[model samples]
Target: MSADEGARHPEDITVPDAVSAPDAEGRPRRVTRRFPLFTRDTARPEGSGRAAPLDAPAPARQWPILAVLSLVGIGLLLTALDVFRYGTLLIGVALLGGAVLRWLLPGVGMLAVRSRFTDIATYGVLGLAIALLAMMAQPDPWLEIPFLKDTLHFTVSG
Candidate 1:
């Protein structure tokens, strides 16, 4: 046999496991496992290419993610400075902006997390939820639900 014939490919050669299954009838069998796409490959999300030209700086290349992160950082800072309602609203707005950028822009850098639809759904839903919660926060809520208090009281006190 030629040297190429003596050298078997990894996938072509399979050794059996120590233990045998009832279905194997005591014969040795090759054990192989399949991996999902994420494990096998790390393809970028759709429209996740650089937002700016290659000649631009790194920050420019990834400005979309930077913008969202900066807004979130500012929101946290505002929250620490005792501006809870507006701070939370700003954070929600940041997420909404990410969703919008992902939707409208052809290349959003790292802002595109998953597929276009999935990223939009995730960001939009989280942003809406946070914004609604901020509007309904305690002490003097802007959008109070009349039945929510009753429901909470019933669940807690009943």
Candidate 2:
């Protein structure tokens, strides 16, 4: 083989027939190719899906979730305002309420941020933890959680 032919990669060898013909203006009209990320089946259908685009107005059915989240926000606001006692209690209640809502109404519109199982597990665990911690808070703890006082002492000391 000639040196030129030997040096050329297989992919570099283009078929003459596949080359674009010259256009009326004498410019080589190349064919442009497009590869879409999603095919017809993979593409999201309009007006049908679990979640809508962020710009769209929220559905009316999501009010319950909004209310629950509002309560949680209020609780956090109270905590920020230095009312630790009532604030913490409210926060716990909100989290527990969220979990209950998730359980009872799986199709709770936008409130179903994640899978039903995940939402329930997260809300329940966090709510219970907060409630427990609030009950065991210092200065004048309200509820006596068995062995928690000793556990906290041990963890804190060592």
Candidate 3:
């Protein structure tokens, strides 16, 4: 027996056929059958692969959100200047405005940080609470809340 007729070694094994099929032109084309690294589809949901169009314009109502936020900032500035009454009022108004925007408009762009009902309820409640608090503040409160005056009496002996 010659060297060719001897027992076949593992290194001498050869693939019987080409892995890839040729194109219409009949050239030897490399076909790749890629198996995904991850077995499950982890990238995103199946149908939501496409991205939004670049040319789509943003909603026009987004400006109101900015205006409301600016109002809150102005309120902060006023508070820093010792005008707590007007400052707190302004903050409340801004929050109320945000609530209104969320309520009236379907899409508030960046302002839609939470669900519609949640955002509206939060803004409205918070705004009303702040406004009420501001009205009941010390020194010279604007509106005298009826029962709150007697309810908030706390005496501490030094």
| Tens digit per residue, CA lDDT, model 2, 1-158 | 78986785655655554437989998768753543333335432221233334565775546656777888889889999998878888888888888887787535565665667787899899998898788778878888876876898999998
By lDDT rank, best first, the candidates go 1, 3, 2
Rate residue 18 of model 1 by lDDT: 28
Q: What is the C-alpha lDDT of each candidate?
A: 0.87, 0.72, 0.72
- Badly placed stretches (over 4 Å) of model 1 are 1-40
Better of 1 and 2 by lDDT: 1
| Best-performing candidate as measured by lDDT | 1
Misplaced by over 4 Å in model 2 are 1-59, 155-158
Off by over 4 Å in 3: 1-61, 154-158
Clashes of each: 0, 0, 0
Superposing every Cα of model 1 onto the true structure, what RMSD results?
A: 11.4
lDDT of 3: 0.72
**TM-score for candidate 1:** 0.73
Model 2: lowest-lDDT 10 consecutive positions = 43-52
Please provide TM-scores, in order, for all candidate models, with all chains considered together. Answer: 0.73, 0.58, 0.58
